[model samples]
Target: MSFPQLLTPEEKLAQGKTALGIRDVVVLCGSMRFAADMAEVAIQESVAGALVLKPDCNMKIAHPLWADPVEAEALKVRLDDQHKQKIRLADRVIVVGDYIGDSTRGEIAYARELGKPIRFTDPEVDPGEPGGDPAAEETAR
Candidate 1:
């Protein structure tokens, strides 16, 4: 008697999504300054029949909850971790802005490590592509 082969993490995620009747899982990554751009991309992804995941909060927004420097820093760390989880779960990543900040760059790297396909709203800013500048920030805008 032989045991079945164990599934890879990507395979496991695909199986789970299939069990849930999800066709495609797309995660959006970008600077919080382009939250509006991300929102637009989310809508487009949804309309295209993808299950979209994105940052749910814009910490840059003036909020009493995160007004304290220490508290805001802690929240930022937690949020970044959560976004990485989203990238792990997603089958693909869509970067939703012309700008790629440090946080977004990290997310893109994580997604690449997971072998997830990545697309950019502004293709010129895609670090994985030819002539794409990883250090570029807000230059395309």
Candidate 2:
């Protein structure tokens, strides 16, 4: 018979928080172009007593670490998957930007699919909100 696998570090952390009754876990999702703005929101979330998780790097900026084309593409894929994992670990998701690109839009859809509560820094861009444009949701779907 197959038994359960060990919890990952992220899972362990989440379990620990739940055991400790620390429920405010927020994940930030948006384009890397608004990385700075997301950082500010992270600070605000932290101050508001949330355990905030966000993009650790802005890969759009030129960097020696991701200088190679193949490496950079692979890293981008890895980072996107990691962010999805963060979303899974989070209790809530926050989209932090005025513009909603394909990636961010996909994140929003995924959050919605998972039944996680989502808030937008720019409410106008929230596709689920009134007057949020059906076109965007169509494109996202």
Candidate 3:
């Protein structure tokens, strides 16, 4: 008379295992050139782009540089510790490119060393253009 017997075999199996919940992703951007003043917009675009293609994903972001660094050691400590923590916690990372060199390179390398899924996506773009406008882009997140 209980619900357990009423449930199909598949439902019973599913009930025994933990639900595979929605995944969380964090993006590591290559360019901080525009991120300084427009951090919110820039980050939003990056995160949205990733989630747009991959719905049901949670997104976080990381800065390539530590702004509040008090000294050289402080800078390394903040960057190495905080940045790595976020990346390690992320389920996946999307590396954006205006034209990649160091920023993309470093982010990709770090994510790779951690054995996370890594992919590259286009920077936001205007309606018809190939890529996004450099000046007006906003960090929406």
Candidate 4:
């Protein structure tokens, strides 16, 4: 009978490195308030050979001038759900912002629950970092 050979730790590490070289399907998550920033990050990731997915935060559709407050709130909920679905499909989530709002915070929590890797555009702005809250800094100004 032939035996199947198991891979050594070094062999497994090599395989992981090989896989890392392949393009990753990354989902960009952030508030619509920072849509432009999110788009910039998406473009940068795409240029780096990653398959990037971002929410369609086009101002034409989501602008408050067009929708009443009630309607706008409903739309925001729907859009947030869609973004969560995208995060479920992604290999990793990149949060693009200096200060994360409630929606982005929820997305980060969801991504953590799913055990996906999470990255931020500004490491200094992370909640755990010292002087991370821009609002505090602004108040001090």
Candidate 5:
């Protein structure tokens, strides 16, 4: 089953380097702590697949947590600046977070503030939509 279009992720990012002249994409996820790595991988893979499908663009994975930090304060500042830089530099930002509370809300808000589209993943729910019908006998048409 498919989700309501509006509820589905925003449309794909289109930036054909040869034609559209846009070259790079930077993806930022809410947290790459543990299992979240899979979601981040999926996010990168999708954009990479798009580039491969068209062969007109290049996508770069921007995992901010990998940034080096000399100290706690420096880490904070670096993260803050890197976040904004990704928004400014990339053609778009993809944020992958679970269906729980707004785990990616801050990223989404940041992207929105920069007028960028935000994408999400529902790990618990099926890919396209929710689970099987709970009321299976209501109207078995």
Candidate 6:
């Protein structure tokens, strides 16, 4: 049996459709510690036809002032605000890990406050399936 080939994000967006037909914008929220995982999820979502947005994890090294704790914290707050704005522009928010860190939790709460739907990538859940705890799905909406 021949299986269908998956399309790249560019191809998917070019087609203007997805398996779920949810081609709206999505904001990916996760800890900087899981930057790679966040990027993977962003790519997957983008391929699945969502316009995915993620923080620039490379900003720390690009800005030398962020090496200082005070400066880093201030920059973090500014970045977090920018992410919240992205969430405001998104149709939904996808948290990228099984464990929610402090920052991720804050982003989730902010997304909830703005009435955006939330989804999570839980290891216990099948990756091939629409994932996230049902309780969280209910609460996010």
- State in Å the error of residue 88, model 6: 0.6
RMSD of each: 5.0, 6.6, 12.6, 8.8, 13.0, 12.0
Candidate 6 positional error at 119, Å? 0.7
Off by over 4 Å in 1: 129-141
Per-model CA lDDT versus the true structure: 0.82, 0.83, 0.47, 0.72, 0.43, 0.71
Pairs in steric clash, model 5: none
What digit string (tens of lDDT, one per residue) describes model 3 on residues 59-120?
22344443343554475555545666666556566555455655346655676666556544
Cα displacement (angstroms), candidate 4, residue 105, comes to 0.7
Looking at model 1, which ten-residue stretch has the lowest summed lDDT? Answer: 132-141
Residues 17-51 of candidate 2 have per-residue lDDT tens digits of 88999888899999999998999999998998899
Better of 1 and 3 by TM-score: 1
Which consecutive 10 residues in model 6 have the weakest lDDT in total? 123-132
Q: Arrange candidates by lDDT, descending.
A: 2, 1, 4, 6, 3, 5
What is the model-wide C-alpha lDDT for candidate 5? 0.43
Better of 3 and 6 by TM-score: 6
lDDT of 5 by residue, 31-140 (tens): 44323454545456566653211111111233455344345446555655666655654555544445323434555455655655444444332122124332221111
Please name the candidate that would achieve the greatest TM-score relative to the true structure: 1
lDDT per residue as tens, model 1, 24-127: 88898999889888898898879988889999988878899799999999999999999999998887888888888888888888876676778778888877
Every model's TM-score: 0.86, 0.78, 0.43, 0.66, 0.45, 0.66
Q: What's the C-alpha lDDT at position 141 in model 1?
A: 13
Question: Candidate 4 on 90-131: residue-level lDDT in tens?
Answer: 778888888887877888778776756777787565453233
What local lDDT does model 1 show for residue 23? 83
Tell me the spans in candidate 2 whose CA falls farther than 4 Å from its real position: 1-16, 129-141
* Residue 71, candidate 2: C-alpha displacement in angstroms: 0.8
